[model samples]
Target: MGGTSSELRDLTNRLYERAEAYGMEVKTGKSKIMVSSTTNTSADITMNGEKLEELTKY
Candidate 1:
């Protein structure tokens, strides 16, 4: 079995909370987050990492 879109959304919300606690700004795009500062942003919490993991994991 694999995770669904709703699961990915849930994980994203969790990550967003974490990011906000760290003073990072999160902007939602079509299916991704537009980070405020390019240099300080990490690709891990963005759509690719979290979303992909959520979709692939059982």
Candidate 2:
């Protein structure tokens, strides 16, 4: 699915929330954002208020 950066961030936040509820944690450094679109827009997703690094290819 495709969405704006804000939507992506929200999704990430929700994921973190669910993970927390289950006593799990997100490995932010191991996480990445893959942009399939060629829009040149930056993927500024954050988990626990910290920005996640974006990868050109995973």
Candidate 3:
């Protein structure tokens, strides 16, 4: 989890809502989200245990 916990928290909330609507639940403990940065460094962004792709020089 990186790139501010607030951002990740928001995303997680949205995902949870969507899943509930579809009779599915997002088990953070069981589910895995990965974040990565696409750039020369290719840094990985992990937020709230979720991984997302981050573009450099954006």
Candidate 4:
């Protein structure tokens, strides 16, 4: 996991791209982000340019 939102966002985007290249689809509606840190910063994560939902303690 990343130490910050931006880092995680970049990582997530790359993952989505790589997955698509392999004919894999990331179902954003069912996807979630779980941050392990104490920080309250939110990551604007997206797949196919759609924002992903964030979850706490999941």
Question: CA lDDT of each candidate?
Answer: 0.47, 0.77, 0.56, 0.81
Superposed on all Cα atoms, the candidates' RMSDs to the truth, in angstroms, are 12.7, 2.3, 6.8, 2.1
Q: Tell me the lDDT of candidate 3.
A: 0.56
Q: Candidate 3, residues 23-49: lDDT per residue as tens digits?
A: 986655565544444434444434345
Q: Which model scores highest in lDDT?
A: 4
Alpha-carbon runs more than 4 Å astray in model 3 = 32-58
Between candidates 1 and 4, which one is better according to lDDT?
Answer: 4
In the range 9-52, model 2's lDDT, one tens digit per residue, is 77888889999999998899888887666656677677776788
Flag regions of model 4 displaced more than 4 Å.
Answer: none
Error of 1 at 36 (Å): 27
Q: Write the per-residue lDDT of candidate 1 for residues 1-58, one digit (tens) a residue.
A: 1144455456787877898899986554444533334244323344424333211111
Q: Which regions of candidate 2 fall more than 4 Å away from where they truly are?
A: none
TM-score of each model, paired residue for residue: 0.43, 0.80, 0.43, 0.78
* Window of ten residues with lowest summed lDDT in model 4: 35-44
Summed over model 1, clashes come to 0
For residues 1-58, write the lDDT of model 4, one tens digit per residue.
7877888888898999899999999898898888664656566778777888987552
